[model samples]
Target: MHEVKAKGILSAQNGMNIYKGCTHGCIYCDARSTCYQMDHAFEDIAVKVNAPELLEQALRRKRKKCMIGTGAMSDPYLHLEKELCLTRRCLEIIDEYGYGLAIQTKSDMLLRDLDIMKRINQKTKCVVQMTLTTFDERLCQILEPHVCTTSRRIEVLNILREEGIPTIVWMTPILPFINDTEENIRSILSACRKAEVYGIMTFGIGLTLRDGNRQYFYQKLDQHFSGMKERYIKTYGNAYQLPVPRGKELMKLVRQECSDAGIEWRTEKIFEYMHQFEDKEVGRQLTLFD
Candidate 1:
């Protein structure tokens, strides 16, 4: 890990990335895609040493409170986070300033910050978003090698539910020939149901493969799943969005399941939930009590 002084911490939309690059080597990580223009090697992990201070400044200057988001380009709780504590420090600031958070990650290390997350949620809102790609443990290991498997994430979700911390599940990047199966979708949604997640965000039964992401994904396929690269080339040569043959049917199933369980599947609604902030600006005016 190397430290970099960031010019700014929060995006115009209030999103933040305390670190650049990711060590959680999900074989198909879109962050590694060339479109993102990551300067260093994907594992080097550029740490924003000034993140906490910058966040405090940003939160303090704002006239109104809004949800502070992180873990979009990189997981905040990557192994480096154990020592850096940048994410932890920033959360503490958000808690102190009474801003909501919508933190995303695929790591179990997030459990370390549960107390602070609970504290923030009590004051404002703090939603934990975890991405679940596949349900099979062995397959999960292959797909998301650096992080804990799906079962553990499910455990985290259940724990969050019990803590009154809302959660969202990102069910996405469904590889066409490998994991795009009805059974895979059903099993994942079943686990989500048990976890009582507030919403499920899915982009259909398919994965996008652009110039940079497609090359890396295919390379991994060549290494792990022999002959898979050739199949992908033949099936989706130079295409961006490669929808599965059963995509339409599988998406129908997902909609029905989400409807039955009352788990949100509407894309716009989920985006609204994430960005829409509550003011709670209802405190009484100061009084000397004379």
Candidate 2:
């Protein structure tokens, strides 16, 4: 890992990535796409040494309070976080400034900061977003190596739920011919329902393959699912979407399951929920006290 002084921290939408690159080694990670133009190796994380200071300044300067998002391009709680604590420090700043947080991660290490997350939620809002790709533990290990398995993430979700910190699960990138089966989708949705997640975000029952990620994913496919790479190239040559065969049926099932479980499934609505900073209980309590 290397530290760099960054020019800016927060995006126009209050989004920030404290690090560049990820070590989780998700076989289908889009961050590996050459379009991102990273000069260093994907595993060699780039730390924004000034992230905490920059976040404090940015939050203080903002005239309006809004939810700040992180872990879009890279997982904020990567292995480096175990020692660096950059994410934790930033959370302290967010809590101190009474700003909302919408943080995403693959590591259960995020639970270590439950205190700050709870404090921030008490003041503003805090939503934890986690991605569940494969339901089977062994498959999850193969797909998302270097991170917690599906069951562990589900445990984290349940813990967060008990804490009253709303959680959102990103059910995505169901690799075709590998994990795009109805049973896999149903099992993941069942876990989400059991966790009482506030929302489940999925574009469809499929994954995307581009220049950088596709090559790497194909390499893994060859190693694990011999002949799968050839099948992908033959089926989806130079295509981007790479939707599964049962896309329509899978989506219909998801719609029914989520609707029945009271879990938000619409991408736009879920995004709106995550981005919209809620202060309902805080505002109501303040009014009553006043």
**C-alpha RMSD (angstroms) for model 2:** 3.3
**lDDT by residue for model 1 (145-261), tens:** 999999999999999999999999999888989889889999999999988898998876788877676777888898899999998889888888889999999999999999999
TM-scores for all candidates: the values are 0.95, 0.96
**Model 2, 1-290: lDDT tens per residue?**
99999989999778999999998998999999999999999889999999999999898898767888998899989999989999999999998987788999989999999999999988778999999988999999999989999999999999999999999999988888988999999999999999999999888778887879988988899888889988998998889889999999999999999999999999988888778876755563211111
Q: Would you list the C-alpha lDDT of every candidate in the order shown?
A: 0.88, 0.90
Regions of model 1 farther than 4 Å from truth: 279-290
The TM-score obtained by model 1 is 0.95
Instruction: Tell me the lDDT of candidate 2.
Output: 0.90
Among residues 3 or more apart in sequence or in different chains, the pairs in candidate 1 whose N, CA or C atoms overlap within 3 Å are none
lDDT of 2 at 53: 95
**Best candidate according to lDDT:** 2
